[model samples]
Target chain A: MRREGSAFQGVGAVFIKELSDNISSVRMLMLELLIVLTAMAALYEAIIALRQNTAEDPFLLLRLFTVSQAPLPSFVAVLGFLIPLMAIGLGFDLINSEHNRRTLSRILAQPIYRDALLLGKYLAGLATIAISLTALWLLVIGLGLIFLGVPPGGEEIARSLAFLVIAIFYAGVWLSLAMLLSIVFRSPATAALVALGIWLFLTVLWPMLAPAFAQMISPPDPRYAALGLDTPDTAIWTQLLQRFSPNDLFGEAMLAVLSPTTRTLGPVFLDQLRGAVMGAPLPFGESVMIAWPQTVGLIACTIVLFVAGYILFQRQEVRA
Target chain B: MSDQKPEGGAASPDVVIAARDLTKRYGKTSVVDAINFDIAKGEVFGLLGPNGAGKTTTILMMLGLTEISAGRVSVLGFDPARSPLQVKRRVGYLPDAVGFYDHLTAVENLAYAAKLMGLSMAERSQRIVAALSRVRLLDVANKRVATFSRGMRQRLGLAEVIVKRAEIAILDEPTSGLDPQATLEFLDLIRELKAEGVSVLLSSHMLDQVQRVCDRVALFRTGKIVMMGSVAELAVQVLGAGFVVEVEADGAGIARRLAAIPGVGNVETLAEDRFRMTADRDVRPDAARAVVAANGALRRLSVDEPSLEAIYAHYFQASQSGGVRDAA
Candidate 1:
């Protein structure tokens, strides 16, 4: 007799187990510490820069993410580098280690379906990333309040909150990617390295290569451009190609949400800005709209990676 | 020869597990090929085989962990492939190598299992405590599994199977890696489960242990069950109805002389004062007389039925000879 099994029958149980396991693991603790230290260091430097600035930037709270000191990078840039590491740290050994420890078969023998187990693990990882980002966000706010002495308005809080949400989404893409690598690779170390390799390629090398690739794909026409080898089409194509990298999307989304004065992610002509004030802050809705596509793109990438991993895992034979 | 299907009315076999020509093939080679057996309610069934004889493969297929290439298996009237949750819900599987989250305490590990079983918070805690105590691990319940010895881990596994209160328990190599005392204790636990009417299907290479616990056993070899019967039935089938008498005395050339006696099938010198003789009838009188005539004092004489060990050796030797004949 086939019972009508609930898809989410044991999700809560597995979710609790996964969350507790991640929370207690020394490995997770170390990764969280690394992210927090880097984020706080970046924020401290931003506060220092804000103290010396004399310009009355209407979006000063938002500038905390984009502005940096001499030795440190911006909070957004630091997170762009470290968020993937945190995700990979939590995810690289998720499945294979169960096999290594000889627990997979035993765990699967439980009444729960495999769907619950995978969903629970993924949700736990996303929750871990969410919690860390929330702490970092609150830390930045606390530092800003201490240094600037004036409480941030609702608009600043909303923008920072949006940036945090996007950061979590960006981290989820890498987390799911790392989880997929973990499923594919039997060795945990290999999984971690491969996930990191992909992250490094996207974050560090893609920006430099994207422009060149874009130029080649949509190279200038000599009939339109005499002196300028790169056309306006090339710039637009470069922006589109760069968006392929999760890091690029993450950086652009943060910039749009944190720097409300940022009117467009792509090239903007002076004619389009003729009537616009030079440094006017965009309304919260406009800022969200500006980052909307990037946020959706990051989320879509996470979902796609997770679905591939799930399909692959479902096909795999459960042997320990 | 008789599979004893439960559908045979009047017998009321109450089959908990029934497999018909079950097979598992990885590519071209079949690992568990066309094997069939039935484990009835409260019966302890043993799958005795050498390493890699496909005992684990069969168990995996039964649990729906591995896809079966051909044939069908029904557990508790449910097809594992189609209704794995229903099968898993009713069956308790103790894997060959029992493992747990080493970081968690014994209580936490059992609690996790209870949660997956969907026990309420109150029932979960009560069962965890009862299960730990049942396995005699209550004293170490709070200790991390990392600190547990191999025997303790095995006990925990047994407790897990017990706590589930399932209709059928599939224990794969349950006694492996444990000390002799622990294995004894583990077997005792299996007996207790059987007393409670839990059908057990245990796979092990240890013939003696299986002989003691299993009501029926299937001798597995090279991806197939070569012989299936109760231990007594196998003993009779292989060696025939006879008693083997060991004459504890070494009479020089006495072994051959004893073979001449009527109803005596064979004789072998056991040690410096011992000769073993096989007979189809009561031959102890003749054995004693033969030993005395050979000028050896028959210090001791003991009669025993053919053992499972002897039966296994005989079957393997017979199969090897058959193979040679077919090849020639």
Candidate 2:
């Protein structure tokens, strides 16, 4: 049957309500505090480490994000690990909490379609992540200015802002995955645990497993092996397998944006590097071009996960 | 058992809700089988049955919260399945064990609902205040719902309906968990909604509670409504004018003597002496005379007004015992 009215009739209302709820929630507070503290520590270590190598490097400010001292990862690395945790924390209980509280039917009984509730929640979660990430980005840059005593180039600001946006998309991928679990499971705790477990597997284990799976799928050429050269086919296969994990896509995108000196994210033949300055930083546009595919991958994964959750939630019974 | 159409057709302006042969099936099992009913504006219509008897399923179908396997339901001249937003905009629902955001204050909770209803900010606060006051929760308007008792939460649920200014209110087991005192207060609030000309559809397993507040009720068994009508009408149909005279007296063969009364149809022995007679008319005086003539000492004599509880029991009992008269 064709349902009457716009499916998005009350989306704004749900969005505003969910946004406020996410912002004021105790879970959000704890996640924000954790991210802020770790980010500050990473920033401090990056500045101390960068002080020893103040030279003709024009991208010193960019190095503040990627440079790390022993015993602590860089700021971008810390974000790569913590962003998914924050997104999952905000979203794992989104739907099931309503079920547990017996509020799903009442809320759905309002003058809105199921589309409004799911979309509103996803947008609100993304917005919350965006706000927190932007704040942390500003804090890091402001601290870098005070500690490093150097102003970032206009291109550097643009790249980091793009990084902030991509980080939000990265957070979106995890948020949608968490929401899917929330719709699939009736218990919030179960959803949370399963989301965390998936995060651990994708971020920690998948990187290690990707190479083995790739070698099994595409063995290196014996001629290339005898020549003491890595097979391009196995290298391509590994990157393809690794891209399945959102962490890999986000990590590569962060590398391209923060470390402009990175010329290529995949295998580059000798012919492609004919006239390239080995360690020279690529232009901002070239760097974004390199990260563009990964950025799109993050967004596409988020939409796919979100649509899957929407379908499940639409079919789910309202009675608890 | 019967899907009698209301006197007027679906075009009748006064019929706020009309369902014809509405059915809900999950796989081969039908949770709600073909059923029909119409609720007039301002009528308190109750769906009464035991747990798992499809009352909640029927209610969900009415709101278009669940898909209907067959037939049609129209709420306020719109098919609930096709125009759910229109139906929902005009109808308010309070689910069994209604919940609110525990961290938000009562006013804040209602304000969210108000926004969903598209109420302007000025009107939102005004309606919220009026609604909270109507449900007697105004003093706790700013208090978080976590501190609320079950009864308080129920009243807050009602407050949400009031804030919406809905034309019809669907309540599923509204008084299930409330204490007797709070239940009475909630019923009174339902009556107040009726007095203000809002139609109500209430579903519950508690026969006595429905009997008090509902103007008409549908008695559900399994997936179908076995009987539907006013309490007095059901009593007459199921109980044969539905009068019961109880005689608590001591004597020999008093049961047989009471059964011999002219208007009495069935005589049940409560004990060696006490007898309960289902009669077409008030037979208390005749029962006492019969007991006396049987050399029974009449200690007590009274008429037990036929209630919905009795009708439900009688309908289910007769059907279960292979008695086909009432079932037919």
Question: Residue B191 in candidate 2 has what lDDT?
Answer: 99
Model 2 segments beyond 4 Å from truth? A221-228, B1-11, B245-302, B323-328
Worst 10 residues of 1 chain A by lDDT: A1-10
Best by TM-score: 2
Candidate 1, residue A86: lDDT? 92
TM-score of chain A of 1: 0.94
A245 Cα displacement, candidate 1 (Å): 1.1
Report the lDDT tens digits of candidate 2 across residue range A112-231.
999998999889999999999999989988988998889998988998898998999999999999999999999999999999999999999999999999999999899999999889
How do the residues B226-323 of candidate 2 rate in per-residue lDDT, one tens digit apiece? 89998878988987877878889998988888888886899988887678888877788888788789888999998877688989998888878775
What value does DockQ give for candidate 1? 0.46
Q: Write the per-residue lDDT of candidate 1 for residues B28-48, one digit (tens) a residue.
A: 999999998888899999999
Residue pairs with backbone atoms closer than 3 Å in model 1 (clashes): B248-B273, B249-B273, B249-B274, B250-B273, B250-B274
Residue-level lDDT of model 1, residues A1-320, one tens digit each, is 43447868889988889988888889889998888888889988988888898788766777888898879998889999999999999999988888788888888898987888888998998998898789888988888888887688888899889988899999999989998998999899999999989988998899999989987999877855887545788889999999999999998888888888888888877798899998777888998899999999999999999999999888787875
